[model samples]
Target: MRLEEIARRLGLEAAVAGKGMAAEVTGGYCSDLLSDVMANAKEGYVWVTIQTHQNVVAVAGLTSVAGVVIAGGHRPDEETIARAGHEGVTILLTPMSGFEVAGRVHALLSQTS
Candidate 1:
């Protein structure tokens, strides 16, 4: 599934940073720890978290995630938004919990895989 489709299917509010929703959503990773995401998230994986700091963007960029899903209706700060836009990181927003978001994304990906 593509990022656009995922957003639509899940009714997520997309707050794309740099690049548009062109990423191919491959896998799912749910974690609130920055280090865990950086270590475990793979390229094309949509990272699900509630962290709204600029460091999230740094980790997303470092790990090469397809996008970052800010669950539980959490919003990123302006600085983080600016940094993500500068770094071309995609950010998707949803009111669902991280576990729910991850499971839904996993289900969608499973269909494709």
Candidate 2:
């Protein structure tokens, strides 16, 4: 599914709609640790995390994730938002926990597959 589709499906709010990101969601991955996310996230996949740091932008860039979803209603700080915008990474916020978001994403993917 597209990034916009995934966001719509999960009722996620867009925090930073980076250039080209809303048009690029293809898959999803949920991780809390930056290292694990950087290592496991695939290009075009939406990354779900509780982390609200600037490093999330770097990891998203390195992994080429389609977007970053900040779960548990958390929002990124100004610096993180700016970096994400600069890096072309879409940042989203959802009220659900990481596990809930991941499960929803998986269910959506399963339905589509």
Q: Cα RMSD (Å) per model?
A: 1.3, 1.6
> What's the CA error at residue 93 for candidate 2, in Å?
0.4
Shift of residue 105 alpha carbon in model 1, Å: 0.7
TM-score of every candidate: 0.93, 0.89
Task: Please give, for residues 3-64, the per-residue lDDT of candidate 1 as tens digits.
Answer: 88898899998787446377887787889999888889999888999999999999998888
Clashing pairs in 1: none
lDDT of 2 at 99: 90
Candidate 2 residue 58 C-alpha distance from true site, Å: 0.7
Would you list the C-alpha lDDT of every candidate in the order shown? 0.86, 0.84
Off by over 4 Å in 2: 19-26
- Model 2 lDDT per residue over 1-113, tens place: 67778888778888887753555556788888998887788988889898998999999888888888999988888999998878778898998998999888888877887
